[model samples]
Target: MAVTLTDVAARAGVSPATVSRVLNGNYPVADATRRRVEKAVRDLDYVVNAHARALLHATSGLVGVILNDIADPFFGAIARGIQATAAEMRRLVVLCSSSADSSSEFAYIEVLRRQRAEVVILVGAAPEDAAYRREMAGHVRGLRAQGARLVLCGRPAPNPHTAAASVSFDDLGGARALASHVVSLGHSAVAYVAGPEGRTTGTQRRLVFAKALSECGVSLDPALVVAGDFSRQSGVDAVRRLLASGASFTAVCCANDLMALGAMAALREAGLRVPEDVSVTGVDDVPSAQDVTPGLTTVRLPLEEAGRRSLALAFSGHDFGSPVVLPTELVVRSSVVAPSAASARRKLA
Candidate 1:
């Protein structure tokens, strides 16, 4: 039997009329009550006769894009590409920001599924949670079954055989190249500031960096590896903690440009010169990377191209049977240099 409004009302501890009003948005409801009703609906997997609505409308004329943080340059660039392609196709783009929260991400996916969007694009890294992955895989299959296409940009596909499409960057290779470059610069004592743990991007990058260091015969100091969110402030705090630990390091590698900028700021405040007193490097050579004083040496990923490719794949209506992997290039700037004798002596002291 289909789950009815009365079931949702009973689960939410509200009347059937209250549940109807909350779902229809035709009557005022308390925020708490609305949240309860929504949770009940999601928990029950109630679709409210979505198939009937699909038959009546036949077309949503909308494409949905889900992003972690729209303000971040990385995400913003991808959004620009997606929006441009969507506008050219005359399909309105609806953007939803999850702010890197798993619950919010799932909620946005559910909302897009209910609207029967023509295409749904999910951008950015996902948390490494088994349950979440399974749930997302189910959601992807559900959307496809409903005649909606799903595209993953900068995110890994849940199942390789699924109908969903994906476009991803070579994160591990980029991280490995960056770390190898720093190691070649004659800096053995290097500090790494990685993105948040449990995130695929951060985990893969950090793992590759460690492997590169090991291959170069340099042991990674646990004290020098700091966990940080992908933000300027987190980078700043990571550096401060490294300094307080009195770990001797001549180079600091950040997972992203924003954190690298923060690390540079902290180093300067501590009276250190870039690539002179200590070298600093970053990944994701964003637009600001070149503008920053003593430009940041980093890895450049084709973010906009990935976005465009994802949208194109969605419109093609054919599964390519494999994801499109974009290449990454190392951008050498003024941020990295050989350790001078003076800096080497200071590190020893």
Candidate 2:
């Protein structure tokens, strides 16, 4: 016979009501009593039917995780961190990808609300449209009005205020550090291959790169700066565009690892040797960075910690503040080096 709640109750010498409370993490039950019920369930190998339990209690012990794209390593790392934390807290997770589309994001929010998630975490890539920002904020407010907590893992839209909790990193500082480091290596004419200009990560990194170059008395050649979606192909194309513009850059800095890797491939095919011919650097030290031949010289951000902090804020019920900024360190690898005097002479010529 299948074990039931009554069986557990009988083994623990408590009412089924007490077992329900302990299992649901709902009502306050004495530690001793809770332990006894848990032990009985374990002894009987009894598992609460999640569907039945949710139907009875109006909650499924589920948390909703909404993201623009789960495939992005940065967001993927965040999701993994959230999953680890949720496992410890005995919560279930439901993942939804919005693909950076406002309609898709709003749709997922509605679905999560209808599903009765206790909390909703949104891993948004900054959206460009102001109307969409307002729409997203309104949905978040509605969820709060219905008593569900909302947290943003990445950059939420700017302008329309969101009272929701947020966890983010210092894109500007991290990008500036990477760019400044390259410029210090005597690369005065450096090209920037930026991600989508509207997204926070892309915009902040590009802006910081510009600022850092300016501080070093080097101006980014407008022809050498190209912005595209954060894809490997975009990186390759951006580099091609830069080369075709007749600008001589001893170094190229990409916004992300994918772009950096792509830039490397493009350079290799064009018979240019990395670091030897042109120094290259990328952001986000993704797993591929360590595996790629020559290894990537890039900036490493604490992506996993960003995810964990997002969950912590949700659970702690913390109020809104400036987004959390994580420290970024530059990883020196075979991809970057001091420009050769020969390359330097080319710039002078």
Give the C-alpha miss distance for residue 188 in model 2, angstroms.
0.7
Steric clash pairs (candidate 1) = none
Instruction: Please report how far candidate 2 places residue 340 from its true position, in Å.
Output: 1.7
In order, the Cα lDDT scores of the candidates are: 0.85, 0.78
Error of 2 at 280 (Å): 0.8
Writing each residue's lDDT as its tens digit, candidate 2 over 1-349 gives 8889999999999999998887767799876686577557645766678674444335456799988778878778889888988888898999998887766777777667657777888885776667767666667665664467778776754454777787777666776677777777778778889879777667777878788778778898878889967788888988887777767888988988999888998888888888788888888898898888788988888888887887778878574766666777778788888899866875666
Model 1 residue 94 CA deviation (Å) reads: 1.2
lDDT of 1 by residue, 41-70 (tens): 766766668764454234487799999998
Position 86, candidate 1: lDDT: 83
Where model 2 places Cα greater than 4 Å from the true spot, the runs are 1-59, 157-160, 345-349
Best by lDDT: 1
Q: What would the TM-scores of all predictions be?
A: 0.86, 0.79
